[model samples]
Structure formats: structure tokens, C-alpha cells
Target: MRSIAKPATQHTITANAKVVDQLPFQDRQAYADARQGFIGTIDPLVITDDSGRVVWDLEQYAFLQDESPTTVNPSLWRISQLHMAHGLFKVTDRIHQIRGFDISNMTVIEGESGYIIVDPLTSVECARAAIELVYDHLGERPIRAIIYTHSHADHFGGVKALIDEDDIHPGGVRVVAPSGFMEHTVSENVYAGNAMYRRAQYMYGQNLSVDPTGMVSTGLGIALSQGQISLIEPTDLISDSGQELVLDGVRIEFQFTPDSEAPAEMHFYIPEMRALCMAENVSHHMHNLYTPRGAQIRDAAAWSRYIDEAMRRYGHKSDVMFICHQWPVWGTDSIRDFLTEQRDLYRYIHDETLRLAAHGHTMVEIAEMIEFPEGLATTWTARGYYGSLNHNAKAVYQRYLGFFDGNPANLHPHPPVESARRYVDFMGGAEVILAKARRSFDDGDYRWVAQVVNHVVFADPDNTSARELQADALEQLGYQAESAPWRNFYLTGAQDLREGVRTDEATLGTSDVLSAMTTDMLFDYLAIRLNGPKASGRNFTVLVHVTDTGETRLAELIHGVLICTPVDGHADADTSVRLDKPTLTGLALGAATLTDAVSAGAVDLSGDDELVYDLFTLFDTFSRSFDIVTP
Candidate 1:
């Protein structure tokens, strides 16, 4: 993949810098709240693993210390500056947070014998560093328990970092999470893992630099840390509301919130501390209902009701409220206001969109028509830093109704390349489209220019003039965007158009995730890879036996469908392969071929070798670096 070289153009700079004057600069309360309980920071904030390789570093974002540049959004620049605040800070008397160590914050609560860590960051290195910071300041203390607030990778990926697997063996240490946490965590990433991971490159702007014109902040934090991601199965699951657990003298009340920000999510309240852990449900900015990275659309109504339920249950009692991302809220009144407004933000988007949809308005029409009421819109936390109203409204529409807008014309519209060819042909040619786009670009109609120029680029990707013009228009749109992901997507698209799509290898295969996959889960992933067209009219049964685990399963491919069934043994199988879980994972991931596995004595083959080869050949490998913008 080529490096990003595109810079903000003159139009982008002027348009973005003007936004600074429009926003209310008097609102410095967030800054004041962010620095309230500061204790100290690791000077120069650079963390390295045992091998002395840098895993998490803040020096690269040193440019944020300066005033917002013309190329960056001032509101986003202000938040980036806030997120740059690093180190151990006291949330209250017994609660402390190690922020800026990773994209997510690690919270530590004082227990009777030791510390209880909540929602460790994205990687083992970063999570380890975060705990080390806590110990460095607060003195050495054993971790008695660990709590995962949600099922997202950032919340639970660093399990082995703070506490060893041996420590949790036989329930030595308590690991608490909501029900279905493990299933959702693995399934969300593994089934559609490649596609989602690829789109995440754009959503998180990982390819961009840490400069004013590049990646400033992800709205949630500065950026995700690069390190090893590991997971530990939960020892205890929070199944319902009012379910309480007393660990190390701290009492936690759970509120189950499945299908909110994540498929498996929940919030907890500490009775002794009078503190509420809102999880990812209530972050500083509006959260994503339909993340740009691509996942199942969240239920906005259920999301709103959960917040309302949290408010009803613990709002008045809680003195301070802290979440997985951003700073905590102090005082009962302030926390109540924050929760209520955030609740209404989602409620309004959901209710209003449905009302418009019932009026026969399409998704795009509803998204443009719906607007935040003045009461909710005026609140700073209600602003779209992570999730915008535009996309969230569309997500609501998609949840009830699907992508189909009930229009026959859009029911079976032409694909991008085909439609682009037709569109360009109908509008004269590339030259004519460019001519009209140039006029729109000059008139500050960047949205229209982007829409039209995309057709030109799709019709002829090699058209350098069209590519540059589209890039220019995208740059301007990015500058005007308040949502971080929107800005990142637009700018990254522009960058890729000018350069080329990034071709880096997917990192999911290298993570500890694959080792955690069960045999059933692995087979389900294999079923996703089965080529239906290629397997048509083919009938075969393969019995897989694991020598290490003494587990056996039968996979039958018939009529273009693969079905897996657990059995003691299959007497009349077409083929049988005996291997351990690791070898099986290798074969599924294309790390090792069936022939190579047999040659290396890692796999024992029986029945027919030709049948086994045919079965393996029926699976298709998806490219991790597929094109997004161009055809």
C-alpha cells in the first residue's frame, strides 16, 4: 500500500477554520471537568513491552499542543487536546482512572485486599502499562477481580495482560461480564471479520498520520494502541437487572443491556462508592448506532430505554458517573442531566425517524428531514463526535425497515460500476461531468460534486483529473464534518483516491482470537467460506477427529449447503482427518494446506485423499484489501 500524501487544499482550510468562529468557545467546562482529579503522569508517556518495543506512545500527537490549524476542525481539535491528558487521576476517594494509556480508559477501584480492574484497554501491552502506572503510583496491589463492561474488542482484548490465565484457573480470580459476552465477541469479529476489519481501516483512520490534516482523534480517544489482543472467558455472567455481586468488599449491581452499543453489554453500579459505571452506553459524545466499520444495526429504542432505566434505578443515588471512554461526571445533578439528555438524543432520533418513515419518506429523506430538538441539541454531550444524527437516523430506518426505501426504482438498482457507466454515458462524457462538477465545487456545493465525481471515477478510475477533483471535494466535506468518523472516512477516501487503496495484511489472523475459537465456531466460520455454486450437486461427508481433545464431528456437504453434526464416530464417512485444534485452525486460515499438514505428520488422513482435497477446494478465500471507493 502506498503512503498517504494528500494534504488539505485551500478550500478545505478556509471552510474548516471558519467553523472555529461559529462554535461556542465559552464552553470550557469539559476541560475543567477532565482535569479535576489529576495526580501525575508518566513523563513523555511512552510505554514499551518486555522486549523494549514501543507499544503505546503519545509523542506522535505532540502537535496537538498547538492551536487548531486551518486544516482541522476546531471542536474536534479541542477534544483531542482533552484526550491528550494522561496518567493516574483520582475519580473519587476509592476510584482511580488511568486515561490516555489506550483508546479506552482503565478504571481501578480500591478493594478490601487489592484492586478490581474494569474494562482493560485494547491490547495486552497497553493494559499492562496501564496497571503498571496504577501500581507505580498507588503501590503494588494484587488484582482480585476483573470486569468487562461490554463485548467490544477494546474492553476485553487485554485480559491476559493484567492477570494470568493461571490466576483465573479454578476461580482464583473473579471475571464478571454480561451473558453471551464470549459468543458475541467472537462471532461479531470472526464471521464477517475480514470485511469489517477492512472497513475499520477507514472508520478509525489507522492509515492516516497523527497530524492536523491527518488523524486528530477518533472522538472516543486519540487512537487504538498497536499490541497483542487476548481474551479470557468470563467466570460469572450478569444475566438480569438487580443481579448483584460482592467482590473484595465492593458491591456491584448489574443492569443488563444487550443489543445496545454492542450485542452483549451491561452497566453496573457500586453501592459503597455511590458510583455508576455506565459502560459504553453513555460516553462523552453521541455513540454509534450503526458504526461505519459495519456491524448489525443497534436498536435505538432499546438503547434509549436502557439509559432511562439506568437513570431511574441509580441516577439519584450516584454521586459520580464514569464510563469506558472519556472523563467522569461528578455530582448527582450533573450526572442526571447528562443521562437524561443522552437518553433523549437517541429517543428523538428513533421516534422522529419512524414518524417520517410512516409518512412514506425514504431513509435518505428521513435522515435529512429529522433534526435534534433545541433542548437536546444545545447540550455538548449530545453533539455528534462519534455518531452523527445523519447516519443514526438512517440506522433507525434500517432497523425497522431495511435498506429498501420501498421504492421500486431502488429495489434492483445497478451496481456502482454499471450505474456509473450508464450515468457518465447519459451525461455526455467524463469531460462534461468534470465541467459541471467544477462549477458545483466553486459554488461550495461539495456534496453534489462528490456524488457526481464518484460516477466519473467509477466509470474511469484512471482519470487523474476526475480523481483529483473528487479528492478535493471530499477534503472540503471532511473539513466541515463534526463527527470524527465522518471526517476520517471522507479524508481517507480522498487520500486513497489520490494514492491507492491500502494493501496491508489483515491483523485478525495474528491475534489471540483464533486460539479462543471453539471447534463449533471454527466450523461455522468454515461454513461461511463454503462456495455454494462450486458445491452444487456434490455430496460428501467428512468426519473430523481431534486427537488432543477426543472430539469428533461430521461435516456434510449436500445440495450447496454444509451441515455440521457432533457424533461419536461416522462409520460410512467419505473422508476422515484426525488433527488437533491448532492444525485445524491453520487449515481453516489457509496458513497450512491439507497436503502440507499430512506431509508434516500433523494430520492423519483416512477414507479417500481425493475427497478430502475436493472438500478443501470447495472453500473460497476472501481478500482483506478489497476496493471500497473505485469499482
Candidate 2:
């Protein structure tokens, strides 16, 4: 499934309150020193069953088992401490939650008969740990229902770990979600699954060994649980504007927001508790207009409108308002104020940027021109930790219209590698650029050094000194960022430039998401990486025959454009490649070469052999660094 949210790997992370207090690194210090700065006040971390017997905890021998210690960067070490501080908190008289497990909190609602779960954490191991925590605190209770607040993975990815179908029994526990939740849930991650997963490694700091000065607060919170992922389809769906329902005796007032932060999302109000559950729609820091990992641009205007609507409808009444991330607010005034600032943050960025661009300014100029008024920026909640005003402003311009300013001269831009080389050639040469960059670096002007050295490296990628300096500049920037995501992006880039990005790791998605991917989305996903322009007006047509479905389709390349159409049940073409789904997946991942498949006869081809080369030609690649910031 497309993971709409970040990794949600909070299970293994720990955010240090004061990095200085942590001890010096020893062997296996990454996991050993996890409980460094701020951990829970309790004597021991343990969750027991009803009988007070031990159940789940910071796994039994976690420190001993974990060998890698990512302690060099203190910020990442600090963030990792947050996960180490996690525990199951009491929400109400009977309800409980395993907090700090993921960005999305898993609520355990106690029904008269059993338990009703809402939004299990991201991974199976973490969810299982959470369930044991609940049983230990509240006495054992059967699971009666599972409610997914939205389509995001953190909400549902751990279903299997929590409860199985056999546990639901004759009167199956109900599984509820917003309308089209299944479609949104599965499609979000898979279509562009490969590239998104790759970028997510940086966005989530997946491969980076955690430590202070490295990866910290994942823009959303601490890192997510690195446990098994699983999913289950919802049996009930909420589709209206205001829908009220009773599940397991608790009354839930759902504000159906189909296309807000997610394509399928909703928020709920608990009347008896006077609590408003604002899903990911409203968060601790300014939200993204566009996330670093790829996805359609979220509507800032629509997001603000929904928050305002939440304020008007439920604000004055909420005694304690809690969200998917961060700590909950208890006072009504405080709740209302937080909602207002978050809503206005999005609105301000949207309106002021368009206001400036109406006169004249390029995307970069608009980004530099617009800043949150001093009042908004000073407020802790509205700071550009996750979504900076600079980038979000540009996203707004990109959203409502195209990149061009109605000027023909600026419409087409040269490709990056080509332009970078020309730029270096015109500006003396790589050696000259490095010398000037070295001076800037020595002066502690990291931003300028990054700009100058990046040009040299992008122009001539082999220059080791340029790469080292740029990486050094990026590492310092990472240390200073208040936002966790920015820290991750900067540090990940630095780590890559220093040691180079690691081998592309494969992500095994949950079955629910994998099953929902449409055939069209599969091909379109591949097209994103197809090396286009290289094909350069080349013409090609080939037939792909499906083994499982007995379906036939023809792919046509005309004028460097690729098109797929379902032809005569079994389209006749120059090539009729034969392969099963597993082999096809292997082909996509490059586990086996085309020739290997051909030799093995796993793939049968006919007509012209050169057509395979033409088909592979249309792929376009993506870059980890494409100049998000200035030169």
C-alpha cells in the first residue's frame, strides 16, 4: 500500500531532551544508550497481562541484541530517546493508549464486552506490544472492533499484529473506515512505490544510524516502529459531511473530510468525554503543502477551511483536544488557539504568496519574499519545522498554476546535468569553483559554500573535494534545523555525499495495499522512471500478455510518448513476452536481467529483438538533490 504518512517507526527511536547528559558512546551504544536523556519516570518499563504477568515492553533484550550505535549525530540520538520514553497512557476512565508508538496514536476503547481499537500503530511488533500493554493495564479484554480514522498506513498497517480473523469469530468485530479508504490506502504508496520508498529512506532517515546531530524529530515526531506491517479492509465506511454513529456503546461524531490531508480522512468528536480527535489534519508543526516524498499537492486552502470548520463546530466545547501526534491540550482556550494558528498558517502562506506573484516574482523570489508575520513565527506551533514558509510558498504557486509566469523566455529550462556543466565552464572551471568554495567554508559560511560547491559537483560529479565540502556544509545545516524532517533531509544528503547512498532496499508492503494496485497504475509507476528524451521520437509497439488474468494489452510509443491500450482480448504484436507475476516483479526490481529471463525461457519474445531496447528507452530518472534551495 502507498504509505501516506511517514515510516511511523517510533518503536525503536529515542529523542534526547539534553544531548549533553547522554553518556559517551561504547560498542553497541546506539541501542544501549537509548534511554539517555528523558525517559519515563516509572521504575521499570513493563506491560503485564491481567494477572500482572509481564507482556510487552522496550523488548526484553533490545539493548543487547542491537549492535549498531548511531551516536555521532546527537540530534538523532535525541529523537531516538523519545521512543525510548514511550509508555501506555490512560486516556479516560476506561480507555487507554500506547503513546509514542507512531505518529498516529492507537486508542483502546473498552466496550462493556471487549475492546474497540482505533488506529493501530504502523508495525506489527509495535501493535502487538501495544495490545499487551492495554491488557496489562485494563485487565484482559477481547477485541470487539477496529476503526481506521483515515487511509494513512500508520492507522491500519498493524492490524494483523493486534487481532486475527479467528479472534473476531461468528459476530465478527467491525472494521470501519472513511469511504474509498481502501482505494486511497493501497494506491497512495504502490503506484510510485519504488521511488517513494527510496526517497522515504531520507525523509524518514530509514538507513541513517540515529544519534545527536543526525536525524531528529521526524517533522511529525520521533521515528516509527521497525516492526512487521499488516493491513485489513474496513467493513464499514463513513461518507457524509457529519455522520454520527455508536460503536461498542461509545458515541462518535465523525466529520467526514474526504479530501483533506489524505484522499480519504476524517475527524471525530466524543460527546461524553468532550474530546475532539483531530487526525493528521491538524498537527504540532506547520504541515506540508507538499511532502518531500512524492504525492499530489495537498490543498492548503481546503486544509485551512476544514480546521476553521472544526473550530466553529467543536472548539468552544472541547475540554481536552488530542491529535494523532504530540501531547494533548487540556484547556478549551488553548485548544481553540492551537487550531486557529495552524489553520491561519496555511491560509497566510497561500494568500500572501499569490498576492506577491500577481505583480511579478519567480518561484524562488516568491519563496524569499514571503515570510510568516512575526506574530505567527514566534508561536511555537506555527514554525516551519516540517513545512517551511520558503518551500510551502513555492508549492502554493505550483498548485494553482504552472511554473511559468506567462513568459516565453522562461518556459523551457535546460536539463540539470547539462546546465550545471555549462555553468561551470562559464565560471572559470571546477578547480576555480572549489578554491572559492574552500574560502567560504573556512569563513563558516556554510550556505554559500553549499551553493558554490554544489555547482562544481553537479557539473563534474567526480570531484571528491567538492562532494566532501558540500557534505560538510549540509551536516552543519542539519544540526541547526529545528524541524526533524529538514534535519533528516540535510543529514541524509550529507551522509550520501560522504559515503554515497546505500543500495536500494526493497520494501515489502502489506497485502491489503498490494492487492488494490490497478494494472494501469503499475505501468504508470514504471513510466515515472523511464529514461525519456533518450527515446527521442522513437516509435515502438509491443504486446504484454498476462499469465494470471489471460489478458492482453499493447504498449505504443509515438513521438517519444508512451501509451497503453487494451487491445483485442489478446493483441497481436511484434513481441509477446511471457512471464508470471513474481517474475514480472523481479524484472521491475532488476533482480534478474532481461537476458537472464530470456535464457531461462521465463520470458518469451518474438518479432524484433531491438524493440526491448526501445521500450526501456522511455524511462526518466529522479534525483535526490535537484536544488530545493538557492545557488
Candidate 3:
């Protein structure tokens, strides 16, 4: 509900159609020919399940006007246009799709009993619309099974709309996903949920308005689902690289490929039909090197290995390979070509970055210098969508070598804001810096404008002129970015520079995430966020017992911090905190603090509150910006 405020600009958005200087026009004839090339280019409309209820309408998205026109990248703008153009398109016979649904395609697989859905968009509302679209044209079908190829929210958030509480049963439809899927899915977003989601706003341009100039695509596709998120526990977990399972009479062979996109992800082949479901493993666009949203760095080497394995295992045998989004590659040659290009794209980034790193290029230096070679670049599918070559190569280096480049000079350095002010002071005055930035801006070299303006904006967040110019520069960069995420990040940075930090209160915050966290994941996420410097030498221990679940654990606070220790269900300890999961969630959300919770009688503490406070002191808060991009 909160609109992050931006410095007043001459630009205005009216309720009626807007009037602004349009950029270079795209050739409609060319795009129409492209549409003709792709058999089902225009998505068919099929709204459903409102039972005459008007829940959502994608028709409005058919056209969009940019809000931060001057700040976004051009490449991202083009993709954004495509993203806006996305609608419901047919995938195959008996299968209908709401293409560009929730940044990815929602595939409706027809089954004898009902429909076997793969990756149900991002929320119940959107998934319902997509399902309705399928039923509107292809006849109504019940949902028998849901296959979650990975743990990402977009792929499985719509489970509730498809099947309700009565669905997860013996005779109820099966929910399939990767091993550790439920645990990882809940943990990934739960632990660092708030900050990550906030950063994701910038990363995916969530709040930035859609216009020719405001926000565009997320390199991967359109923007993320700002609506509610839901998760369906996978009834089937595929753990191995090669595994077979039949869901609702559909014979599916899954190939587990973890650590590429999400920590838990996979792809499966429908052998009898000679059709391969690539899942999100191989899409029409390039994947991200490192996501803008916070997460553990993905392994590029392992990613390449799994892609190759999928090709060797399923490429030749399949007639058509349909991905989770975009379109499908019909025929063995088409699928093989697509797989070969994608595989080499990762391989190229991995090997070349290692070679450059061996030659003593630092991560930033490597990212700047390394480019996707012809083998990878000539193929449009390898273009940065979800992942870009710049970040991915650096991720490869980070995976193999630690953040350090073996240089002692770079071992410890002052933070960027502090260092930027000093650098400007050394370079003379802010006037001189502004002059140089002006020249770069005039050259239409937005990247350089952003780089130089960084000194001023970071040095002084209150500098209105600096914020305005920097945002302006970023808008232009967003306009040019080929990747949706790159555009989103660029525009988001510009927005933040102009408007200030937009902490999404309407959305769930960090403490809220902490409260819902399970005992296991809470401890793990706490360990990561724990500030070691603050917890120097204090030590204490507390035993926790979930009254409702009867789960017990011994949490030790040593060296001024809390650590997870062996606490069996029967373990005896000094103090115990008795509360239900929701009660803990309330405490996590800051709705109730330690003292408040205890005073409210919601928390039953046996031993000293001082020790608990001491233990709480052991946990560290995480930093939103840890310098992933440029140091």
C-alpha cells in the first residue's frame, strides 16, 4: 500500500492516457512476421472460476506506460514490452497455457481423472485465472496432480486455488517436487524473507510502475507477483539425478538438478509421449549469474554438468521439449540445438572466467572483461533473461575461489559510502565530479553516468540533485538493458536514489518471517545473521519446548550468542520457553517482544529472562547490501 516517495519530477501520470515523447518505434511488421513464425504467438483469453467473479484481468496488461521513463534501461524496456504482451497461449493438444503468467508459463497437463498442473504461477488468484482460461477453451478438468519442478514460489504458489485442504490425501491428488523441497522452499524465503523480498522489489522492479520509461522486464520475464504467496508440500520428492515416477497415470522420469536455479530443482521426461518437460532448467532466455534477490551463490560448474546430463539422458529420446515458460522446441533437432546452446553458454562462462581468474583478474575485473563468445551469443535463447553472463562468470569464480583475490591490500577495506566521500574529496570538489557526470550523461553512456554518480548519491543520500541525476541516469540504463532483472535493478536503484529506501510495511517484514520459522531453520538463519563481533564473549543456554508440537531443542548462547545444540525431545535443561508456532511467529514479527510476550503470558519462561535476553543478544541482524555487485 505504501508507495515509495520519489523526488518531485515534471513527469506526471494521469488517469487518462498519457502523452510523452515515444522512443524509437519497433517495427510492427517485423514483430507480426515473428508472430507468424511462432505458431501460437497471440495468447487466447480464457478467464475462469470467478463464476462471474471479476478477480483479475490480464487484458489491462496488454498495454503499459512507463513511470520512471528516464531511469530504466532500454534492453529491459524491449523485454518489458514483450512481457506486457504476454497472454494465454496454447502449448499443445490437450494442454493449454497462460503464457507469461507470473513471469513464467503455467502448463495445464490433461490427465484421465483431472488436470496435472506444472508450476502453478505465483498465487492462487493468478493460477485460478490461468486454470479458468484452460477450462474455458479445452473443457473443464479437475486437478489430479501438481508437479513442482523446483522450489521457487512462482512455480508452485497457486496450489491452493487449484486444490484445497482436501487435496493432500491418499485418494487426493499427489503433489510432486524435489527432495528437501518443502524444507528448502520454506527455509529459503523464511529465514531472510523480509530483506530479500524488499531487495527483490528492487531486483525485480516490483513497485516501479509500468510505462515506456518507468519499469520494464526482469531479464527473466515480467515483474514478480506482488500478490499473496502459497506453497504446496510435494507429495513426491525426486532425489536422484535419474528417477522415474508415475503421477496420475503420467509416466514421468525426473532428473534432479540442484544448485543451479534454486537449491532444490529438477527436470523430467514423459517417456511414453516422447515429450520432455525442461521445467525451468532450460528456458528460451539466459538464467541469472547471481540473482539480484539475496541467496547463496549458485554453482555454475554444477549447472553446466546437470544441463549436459539432461541432454544426454532426454534430448535424443524426446520429440518435443516444452519448457515451463516461453514456448516449446518441437522436434529432436530443435530441442538438441536449444540444449547445446544453453549448455555451452554456462560452460563458456565457467571455463573462461576460470582462465581469466587464473591470469589474476579480480571478480569485478572478470565480470567487466568476460563476454559470452559466439558459440553462446549467436543463440538468442542464451541471451540474459534470468541469468546474465556478467554475474554468472563472477559467481563461478566466487564458487571456486573465495571473495579475496589473494591480495592483502583488498583484505579489509572501508565501506563504500565512507570511501566514496574520501575519493571525491581527493578528486577536488563535488562540482568537478558533477561536470564529468554531465559529460557522460550527454554521451548517452548511461553505465558510465551511473558509475560516476554513485560517488555523490552514496556520499550524500540527501543530495536532491545527485539523486535526481542518478535516478535519471539509471532510468536510461534500464531502458537499454536486455535483461529484465538488470533493468529492474537499475530502475530500482534509481528509484531508491530519488525516493529513498522503501521498506515494504504492507508486505511481511523480517521479524514476521522469523516467527514462522521452524526450530531447525530459525537456528540456521539466526546463525547466519548473528553478528559475531557483538557476541564477543557472553555465554548462556536455554531449552525450548514447543507446547503444541512437543518439539524440544537446546539453544546455547556462547561467546555472547545463541547456537543450536543437541536437544532431544527428552533432554533436560535450565529454562524452557513454552509457546505455539503462531505465538513464536507473533514474537518474531515484533508484535510482541520478549518482555511483552512473557508479560502477556503467551511465553512460559522457567529460568532467568536475563539469560534469554543474553541469548537473544547473540543473534545478529543481516545487512541488506553486502556488496555483491561492485565493491
Candidate 4:
């Protein structure tokens, strides 16, 4: 009863309809490319884990088959239709791809006697399903190698689903990845993981329904699989640009492209098949320089250079180029054209943004002013299906110059709730602002209405009129959004404003990631959890020893900061705690308390066990779903 979602307004429908005329809706090459190399798929196309909990259901996207509805963006609908194509696809004689199983594609390279899997999907269930599909079609073969092109979770998280630790040893399934893979993977998905996952729900519309007025596509794929995500450390690391490897008798040359799309990423070329894999560096649509879900801002300039490098190295030699997401490009000329446009897409966004910034324009001004050139504007691959010109332009500015807009007034602005109250008061109170916002909403100025009405909601979240009006404004914006993330964020925010926050659907399972962490990483994460205020006046020391890893860390709580460092032995400490790495991992994962571990004989605490207990008490447990649309 709390849900107040409405249909698309005339303004939003008219705005989306105009996009059909502005862009090349008649271009069917993308459709053909998407449907190319299609094999058989599961009849129902629903994946589940051992518990029978459904992980992915392609049936939800069945609504995407029809004509573009008035409630959805036409350009986005066109891509969503492409994303709905589920099944195993034969890319070439030696290559096959399992697409629409997850956000990223799983490329199966037929080796001499086994298979080489590259970039498995986000979850264990999805990866297992993909492998099962491969087994059903091409027959079962030992997995010779698993290649992780980048550090993103979607690429490597499902590794355990395919193979275990035994398979990673020598003469077994060799796990290979780019340099700094483990470091970036642990940092991105572990250190800031909780906050990122919370924001990701909004960006991905995990709470929204899959209907014409709700989530249609992620711009990259249908959706992220809701299942256990696992990780396995790589056995081989590729650092150099020209590094080559022979896995299962297949010769592959690599081009390391770090800090482009991900912190540790590479583009590989299969010389034997003459097929290039660009990883996530090149997708069908424009990618985010700064993703809305939150992470390090990607290097647009570096991203462009990687594509240019890939083009020079494998452009003419390759007939088909497959990526981690979306569809693949075939034919030399077409692939060349695709790479050229894709290269210019990021270059243009990066170069022009800095150019505008140097002209005394602020980040906000640059975002509004920047626009793609005619050639790129018309190119289907250059469209902002995931990333938008507005936000990406701001990202470029944020990269070169920090968040401060070079104005003192802009610096040190009040926090959201405080600022909203002041803004509403200055604008002559809530009712007056709502009246003005309604007029702007009627004029189809949904952006302005959303912006102004947001202040009213934050100032007084209980105001039903202001909340409904803001929800209406955000809903209209969602309908007009070409970027699925943008649409999702708008719609989710609108939903939260109406029905309140839904904590039930929050998906963040980092225990597998935690178990894979090294002892040093474990301590680093523990230090992050230490509550400063709680330990301000108290100073103590605890020496931790992990018997399994042979790692001893001296954790000192001094001046409200938890500092951890490796030591030779347990000396110069008030207390000493000894446990296996698994027990420590369980403690870090909140599976058990220090007292529980000690009572169960999993931990051996000497000297001052109370001090260790106190230290554990100081660690703060974070909330998975914090308020976003409200204060």
C-alpha cells in the first residue's frame, strides 16, 4: 500500500519518443550481431544454487520482446532486447561464449584437450550453470586454465564455482591474471565493499520490479546474479605488455592495460584463432569513467590508449572480437571502425572535459556543456547506455581537479539535511517550493523539479505532498533515462521516498572474499573497523598469531587509531592471541565473537584476554542499508 509508482507522464513519453527520431533506430546491425552465433539455451533459463534459491531468471526480461513502451527509453529498450538473448553461442570453431548468464560473458576457448575459461560471471550459481551449458553442448573437458582479465568481482568472483585450490597447482588448471589483481580485488571488494554494495542496489535497481516502468537492462547485461560470489588467488601473474602464454596448446599474447577500466586489467589476443578479447575495456556502449555505485574514477585517457593499442596489435589479424559484456564484433573493417569510434568516445570525453575546465568552467558547468561530436554521437557504441555524457564529463573534471569547484562558497558546504532545511527556508518554506515545483513538473522540467523537491523531502521527510511530487519528478526522469543505472537510481530513489527503504533485498555476501584474504589484508580490514571514539582515551596492545599462515601481527590501539604491523614474536604486548587463519577469518566475518572463539578452544589467549576482548568490542559493525533518499 505504501508503493505509489505511476505510469509515464505525457512529458516523459514525448521525450523518449523523440529519441527514436534523433538516433538511428533503423540500424539493425546491433541486432544481427547480438543474435549471431546463437546455440541452444535452457528452456526456462532460470539458474539456482544447491539450496534451490533462484539466482538468475531470464524470464523476467520477457517483457523486453515487445515494441518500446512509452514508459521506457527507446534506445535503452533496443539494447535491453539484445541483452535478453540467453544461451550458449558459438563465436568461432575454436571459441564459444556463454552470454546472458550473468553481467559478464564467459568465453570458452577450445584448447588441445581441455577448455580455457575467461572472465566467469559474478556468482557461483551462474558460473556453474554456464559450465553445465558448455558440458551439455560441447561435451565435458578438463578445465586447463581460467583467465581473469581484470580485478573486478564480475570477472573473477565465480572462480571457486569452476575449480578449487587443488586445480590451481602446477600441471592442473592454471589460474592466470594481470598484475596487482589480488590487491585491487581485495581493496575494491573488501575495504569499501559494504558501502559500494549499498549504493549498487540503487544503481542496479535491485529493489525495483522488472516491468516496462521498472528495470529493463543494466546497459551491460540483464542483471547481476544474486548468489554466492567466490574468489581464488591466481597462480600466474602477467605484468609485461608483450607477455605470452601457451595454455592447452593455444598461444595467447597479452597487452596489460591497468587503470583503464579496472585497476588491474589486460587485453588478450588469441593468435591461433585470430580472435581478440578486449576484456571490459571495449563494450557496445559508453562506459562510466566514474561508476554511480562508487569506486576509483577510471582513467579515460588511459582507456582510449588501450583500445588504440589493441587496434594496432590485432586489428587486421582478427576477424572476430569478443568482449566481456554485450555482443561481439565480426569482420576486420567493422571491428576497426568499432575500435576507432570506441577509442574516440573516451578520448573525446576526457580531452574535451579538461579543455572546458581550463576555460574556467566548473565541474557542473562542464557536465552541462560537453557533448559528443557528430560521428561519435551517431555511433551506436558511443551512446551512453551505461555511462552518460553529463556524469562522465564531471568524472573527468573530478580526476584532474578535486571535488572543490575553486570557489570558497562551494567549499565546506553544509551537509545534506542541514543544507536542505536552509534552502527550503530561503525559498519561502515547503508549501511555496512545492507549488513552484509542481508548475515546473507540468512544464516537463523534471530535472529542475527533482532537484528542488529533493530539498523539501530532506528538510521534512514526513511531508506527503512534497514526497509524492518528488517521487513523480524522479519517476519521469527514470522513464526518459537512456542509461539503465541512471534510470534505476532515479526510480529506486522514488520508491524509497514513497514506500521507505527495503532492507530485505540488500545483497552483499563478502565472506568468500574475506576467506581468500591474506593475513596482512585481514589486519588491514580489522584496523578499518576500529571505532575511534570508543578507543580514544584507552591504549592497549594485542599480538595476533595465525598458526596456519605463520603470520604474527602486533595490533596496537593508540590515540584512537588501530595500527597493525608484522612482528617476529609476541613481545611488548599486554595480551597475545593465537589462532588459525580460518578462526581469524571467522572473527573478521562476524561469524563468531572473540569470547565464543576462546570458549570453543579455537583461540588461545594469554597474558590479558580481557584486553583482547575489549579490543574486539571496539570494532564497529556497519549497517548494510543506510538511509540515502532521506537524512
Index of the highest-lDDT prediction: 4
Clashes of each: 0, 41, 48, 0
Per-residue error (Å), model 3, residue 405 = 2.8
What range of 10 consecutive residues in model 3 has the weakest lDDT sum?
A: 11-20
Worst 10 residues of 2 by lDDT: 1-10
Superposition error at 543 for model 4 (Å): 1.0
Give the per-residue lDDT of model 3 (tens digit) for 428-466: 757788888887776666677788778876776666667
- Taking every candidate in turn, the Cα RMSD to the unseen true structure, in Å, is 1.7, 8.7, 5.8, 1.5
Give the higher-lDDT candidate: 1 or 2.
1
The residue pairs that clash in candidate 4, if any, are none
lDDT per residue for candidate 4 within 98-140, as digits (tens), equals 9999988999999999999999889999999899999999999
TM-score per candidate, in order?
Answer: 0.97, 0.78, 0.85, 0.98
- Model 2 has an lDDT value of 0.67
Judge candidate 3 at residue 114 and give its lDDT: 80
Highest TM-score model number: 4
Question: What is the C-alpha lDDT profile of model 1 across 1-631, one tens digit per residue?
Answer: 3444455566767777776666666789998888889888888888787798887889999999998877777777888888988888899989999899899999999999999999998999888878878888898988999999999989987778888778877647899999999888888988898899888888888888768777888988998987888988889999999999998889889999999999999999998899999999998888999999999999999999999999999999999999998899999999999999989999999999999998999999988888787787656787788999999999999999999988899999999999999999999999999999999998888999999999999999999899999988887787777888998998888888888887875434735667677888888888888999999999989999988878898989999988888998555688898999988887776667788888999999888878988988998878888888787
- Candidate 2 C-alpha lDDT tens digits along 1-631: 1111122112112222233343233334323322322222333544443455543333432342233233223433333343454566655555556666655578777776888888897877667767876776667877878988888788888898777766555567888788989887767876666667767777777756544445445757566655556777677799986788777777888888766788898888888878888888887568788878777778888888989999889999987776666556656998898899988998998899889888887778898888778668556567565677788888889888767776787778676677788888988998888888878766667678787777777776667778777877776666655556766877787777766556644443325566445555545555555656676677767887767766566877676566778776676676666666555555543445677877888887777877875575455434433333212
Model 1, runs deviating above 4 Å: 1-18, 50-52
